[model samples]
Target: MAQQYTKKMIRQVFVQMLNKRPLNKITVKDIAEACEINRNTFYYYYTDVYVLLSEIFQTELQIVIDKYNETLSWEESFIVAAKFAVDNKTAVYHVYNSMQRETLVNYIYNVAGNVMIRFVENVSEGIPASEEDRKLIASFYQCALTEMVLRWIAAGMKEDPDTVIRRIGQLFAGNIEASLRHSAALHDS
Candidate 1:
């Protein structure tokens, strides 16, 4: 059997390659070479570049979720997430500029959606939101967050993510909750 490689090793190699080149220009051979492993070994750990990309975002997102103690606000949680992306700006920009941008966008949207779903559900724990409405609410949050993050990255990731996140919180503060309630009411009626 081939020697098992740890996620840390894969991640380190991946980040190093991303720093020097675009995602599309990065071949598994490049990754293997950077990590001093064979192409087959890289394949053993990841089927393709996109899979590795998704796992990176998912891992960071999971960390954001895990850091919250259930007492903090959604803004705080979102800030944690946004900061993670900002901290990984180079890797993010490489991925964002690559052919895999669409897939990466989808993953980010899914992550944002999951976070918003938790927030909305917790906030409206006693409210009666149908499954469809709940999904709509989550989708809205996901779409909004994904677009904002993409735009932020496209603009060179110049602004502070914390500032962007705070602005988002300020902009959506009461409106999002009201919109959710209104959408749920409309669906029920």
Candidate 2:
């Protein structure tokens, strides 16, 4: 419990610093001073600032995943993710424009991949596609979604998530199951 609290405190301080400045500009000393913890305490919890950033990304991704798992709607899941990025605009922008952008991209890819896979599986419930086919289709959509979200963040997240989600829903409506069926047919033929 104490360890968890310390980790949380370290994360909080890092986030505050991230919002104020770029990831490259922030250091372990900054986090330790801000958290009022010693450098060894900070190092004990995290190997480096990047590790801390990765933990933050993973924690935030899990929260989004858990929330969407309950609802089980791809659109809603994306909205949750978009809202998170929008809510953390300053911090996100700082990271997005910094050297650690690949870290952010990786997190987006992973979370989006999981969400897309679950969505395809749920929607294609009655379809007879192989597991490989499902994964391929999910990967296709995951790349699209990840790129879209990255572009949205790059554009300062100006567009409303509801508008974007609705447009995406219209654009991809019925496509996952259709693609799955088509792939299954091709494999059998």
Candidate 3:
């Protein structure tokens, strides 16, 4: 529990620092000073700032996943996730614009993929969908959502979260059902 507390403190400091400036510009010394911990203490929890950033992404991704797992509604889950980004615009924008963007992109892809797969599974419950078909469908929607969110961030996240969520909800409303039915039909034949 103490370790967890320390790690959270380190992450909190890193996030605070990240919001203030770019990741590359913020060094281990900066984080250590902010956290009031020694450099070695920071190293004890993370190898470097990049690793710390990756862990932050992973932590947030897992939170989104856990929330989705509970409700299994992509719309609600996505809105919740989007709200996180919207609320932490400075932190998110810093990461998005930083050299560590690939890390953010990869996290987006994985989270999008997981959300898509869970959504398809929930909608297709009782329907038999081959694993391959499920993967293909999930990948398709994952790419679309990931690209859309990336574009939104690139545009400075100017759009309201509701507008973005509503637009995406509209685009994908019937598509999942259609794909599930098509997959089931192909399996029957």
Give all candidates' CA lDDT scores: 0.77, 0.86, 0.84
**Candidate 1 TM-score versus the reference:** 0.84
Q: After superposition, how far is residue 135 of candidate 2 from its true place, in Å?
A: 1.2
Q: Which whole-number lDDT from 0 to 100 does residue 32 have in model 1?
A: 77
Q: What ranges in model 1 sit over 4 Å off?
A: 1-5, 180-189
Best-to-worst ranking by lDDT: 2, 3, 1
Residue 129, candidate 3: Cα error in Å is: 3.2
lDDT of 3 by residue, 1-189 (tens): 988998999998888877778877899998888888899999998999999989988888888887776455787777766766777787888889988899988888888887888888887787787779888998998898899889989998898977777777887688887887888899999
- Candidate 2's TM-score reads 0.92
Predictions ranked by TM-score, top down? 3, 2, 1
**For residues 23-71, could you state the per-residue lDDT of candidate 2 as single tens digits?**
8899888888888889999889889998998999999888877787645
Candidate 1 C-alpha lDDT tens digits along 10-118: 7778877787778888888887777787888788878997788878877877887788656866678777777756666787888888878886787678668768888
